[model samples]
Target: MSDLEATKTRYEVLGPLLDERLLRLWAAREARAIGSGGAYQVAAATGMSLKAIQTGLGELDLLEALPDGLPLTPVPGRRSNGQRSQPRVRLPGGGRKWTEDKDPTILPALELLLADEVAGDPMGRQRWVRSSLRHLSERLAAQGHSASPTTVSRLLKGLGFSQKSNKRKLGAVGRCPERDAQFLYIAAQRQTFTAAGLPIVSVDTKKKELIGNFRNGGRSWCRSAPEVDEHDFPSKAVCQAVPFGVYDVTKNAGFVVVGTSYNTPQFAVSAIARWWQAEGRDAYPGADRLLILADGGGGNGSRAGAWKVNLQERLCNRHRLTVTVCHYPPGCSKWNPVEHRLFSQISKNWEGQPLRSLDLMLGYIRGTTTRTGLRVSAELDDATYPKGQKVTRDDLGKVSFKPHADCPIRNYTISPQIADQQA
Candidate 1:
């Protein structure tokens, strides 16, 4: 057979069950299969991890060829079975013909960047990363490879090798008692048949505001002339709208409090009270308890001083209902509904519009709309938001909590609609 025919024969052996991901991997180091060793070596040579290599091997539909059990070849020269042992398939690194050519410029520049020595100074490091593409381009040309630096930056980015560290962290592995308990609680709730019974509410405070007239995001008409700033004038810190936003899973509707100070127990309880009175009470009529999914940070945080006990007291005092709050792990705040459902739309609606005045800001917020048929209409309550509102020991001690304390935190219900599953 000709060289081209031999190459075709090699790929034909790769099973049909092999998906695109595995096919691409095998195609990378494909060669004549007659004496080719399988995917493990190919993966190593190509710099893929062992797990990836194993997945590629798993796609092979070699059922017709592979025996049910392997026969031991007792001696070096011979097989115990009547049929001869399968030939040791020696694979070559040069696989299929070029389906697509990689951007020649980017690869070489990336190589140069990875191989280069870092300067000790921070400024020098930043400058080098920005300018490396230009230098690498020249090197590539000298080495008979054509590429631009922009192409290199794009390639590195695709590889997830950022100039700065990606701050996201993975959840803990193995025995994490607290996390395991949270998972069990959520699982138990899901087993409930009633929609209102298993309430899952996502709660969070929106991004903090810079208490002054600052450049807001979204597009606006570009300034005809640049306005001069007076450095001599005292800069004012803008008071933040510490909005406590919540989303009910069953209703698919959200409620929020545009408070200036929400770090205290009173303010936090007030937001929940507003929510229970306005949203949860009418919708889930029989529900007596509320389940809140809040972020680990901000005023609604689980770590915040006396937050849970204080909230429980408040719930008992006002609504005669029990309240339980769940916190999403750190850096997982993006999963909160308020960020996507409420704040994202608000940002989009007010894009490029300067939050020049409180009325304008309030108008922008109240006017936010979504194609999903949800419109966020907000109110600007111009009331004094006192800071450092206390939730003292005496305050909590004065109120009574339900069930006298022997309940499993997970098995406990916040809403009144919680019915026995067997019922």
Candidate 2:
């Protein structure tokens, strides 16, 4: 066939089978088959550049004349034929190397730049910095490295850096020296209560929800996303739902009392009392004591005198059971089992679903359950609870309780004040 006809034949036969690399090799093979000046004809037929055809021809020549008849060892991933089996989109170890790799001092310079923003003890293992990637990139550039914010981000990830939100896990600004000791003590107390077949519950107020068509913070599958009011103004709300949860630690059951009123000590105690009447009494029959694990702050806070007084008057007096209260160290409410085990599930259940009415909020809470056999029951406490109700010195004196030897402020027991028995 003529050189033009040979090139046309090669294109028709190999066009579908060959990629860029193979096509170049095939064109070189066709050029040789058609004899002299055939490279020009193949290039015209295949639309391959003349330089590519010449390079392929050179590779074929080199392969044909191997040194001392050494066995042809083709590239590991390439086909058996001398032709390269893959396109050269990228060469080996090609493209731009990471800026940190190119400049060894970039990461070290970044650390030095973030030294002032590092939180916690400098010598401590856990260190955190609060700086934006753009700021970091600028700082890197100032230190004589060419890095954009994107490059800085990639380098930071390689150096085990990540964007982290502020965790409330940091101990109080003025942290107690006995913080860890208190945690250990609380754990031991819980173990003791569990062993004795006594009832133990973690108590905490889930973030209050505004009852109205407001934007909740998650997604639900529907035909279309629900439209909510643009503004989340409290004035536009019908009422706020204050959920005080009592999570029975052993039973994996939850009792959430949705109060339309303030989250006072009275309301906190009321929720526990309601749990006892509804579920706790049956769950722990003949139990002499009740253990409450709570945060160090809030309505039932360790420092709240009214919290103690109300516990004395409401829970202890009503049930006639010795109530042992253990408050987690300041800024450690996240560790409370109620927060993860119960409240989280409830929040997830109602997420993205607007609470247009108090009843809807209560219904959502009650319907919350988990595959791990978590059963939650919710009640609406419409009774108004007065806030800032102070407990008098006389009332405080009437309360009977003993502080634990370890961490007195965090661990305490409030007993039913039996006037006749005490007398």
TM-score of 1: 0.49
Residue range 297-384, candidate 1, lDDT tens digits: 6666654545555565455445767665555545445544556656666667766665555667777777766565665545444456
Candidate with top TM-score is: 2
- Tens digits of per-residue lDDT, candidate 2, 221-252, equal 89999999999999999999899999998899
Q: Which candidate wins on lDDT? A: 2
> What lDDT is reached at residue 105 by model 1?
53
Segments in model 1 whose C-alpha atoms lie over 4 Å from true places: 1-184, 187-194, 197-199, 220-238, 381-423
| Candidate 2 segments whose C-alpha is farther than 4 A from its true place | 1-172, 419-423
Query: Could you tell me the C-alpha RMSD of candidate 1 in Å?
Result: 18.4
